[model samples]
Target: MCNTVKVSPRKLDPEIRTALVDIAARLLAEHGAQALSTRKIAAEAGTSTMAVYTYFGSMSGLVRAMVHEGFARLERQFARVRQTDDPVADMLVLGHAYRHNAKANSHLYAVMFGGQSLAGFSLTEEDRQYGRYTLLTVVGCVTRCIEAGRFRTGDPLLIAHQMWIATHGLVNLELGGYLIDPVDADRCYDTLLSSLIVGVGDDTKASAASMRASRRRRRREVEAEPESVAHRS
Candidate 1:
């Protein structure tokens, strides 16, 4: 069983659902999840509370709607990245999107990952499957780089986690006020990762070309993840 919110996308009038979702997204950003009640939503939407119920059925419904909507937006971000023929370059692009999206919506990111709700909700397969494509797209690009001998060989998810940890740090530091002075966050991240990519191999590596070939060989050896990697949560 799951708790829901009012004005859920499914429950809303087709004409007004888009407005309802926009209101909820803004409210989530400005006021956090606790403020997402029918009273507040209806008031903000210039409607009666009864109208919200007529649209969303219950509060639990609205929450599910919001979660799904969040994932949909995330998917759109990744979709904009050009799938370069060069896998390493694509991986870098994926890294950039990861940090950018999280920073753009820190509060929502916190709630999505931190699970701050008073009433817990269990996502159905359809809901949970949302936005997963973004991560898998990265994994897929990494898989290509591995096959190309450009990146280290390991479990794709493990490699994906490493990228995640490094990229997530950008947001963590930005939130902590680490980028207030001389450091340009984007520059630091690109430089730091370049150094890391260079260091991941050894002195025995004959040249950049050889190292890339080695990476390809290793990726060829590693197994691919299940198709379900698309889910974000």
Candidate 2:
């Protein structure tokens, strides 16, 4: 009888786990979920195929982990946004941040929102609750707006949900390449946010006037940039 040598599994590393998830996310984005496999992910992550099983248990588990990590990243981005005296402005900033984060992680964003993006993995209730909690940050901002008398009296959660719907729609369209013109996309987003703010009971005239003033200031700044550079030259 011949004695067989069996090698033990490599020790699990948290760093390696994170790298795997990140690489998987990129793969899912670039190649879609159908292309995701232990071999491909391991190759990209520079780890053994067993590493994926060790960390996430299976391909479905890995997809679930990606969804969780995507929300965690969004939560971090939301946490970093600076709160201000103007709740509406703060909400606008948060909305912009949300879009920025989504765009930066478009592949992850696709997995997070597009249920069909992952082949066999469906998001569990816990996964969805985590997503909802992230939305609570927006709800908190809306609550502050209502309390500060900036937004008209209504359910803060409902208003926040409406805002999210509008924002998500715009971001989804832009990410899917439906919104072709960047300038037009930006204008459309700004207009939608302003309209949503106004619909929620903010003074329409004041909001419109503020938007106009903002546009004018941006125009002035754009006009001044070349002159300022020429002066330095």
Residue range 140-227, candidate 1, lDDT tens digits: 8768777777666767766776776777777688766778788887578766555545544312333344335433433222222225
The residue-by-residue lDDT of candidate 2 on 35-90, one tens digit each, is 69888777666667887888888888888887887888788767666676666767
Q: TM-scores, in order shown?
A: 0.67, 0.82
lDDT of all predictions: 0.57, 0.74
Which is the leading candidate under lDDT? 2
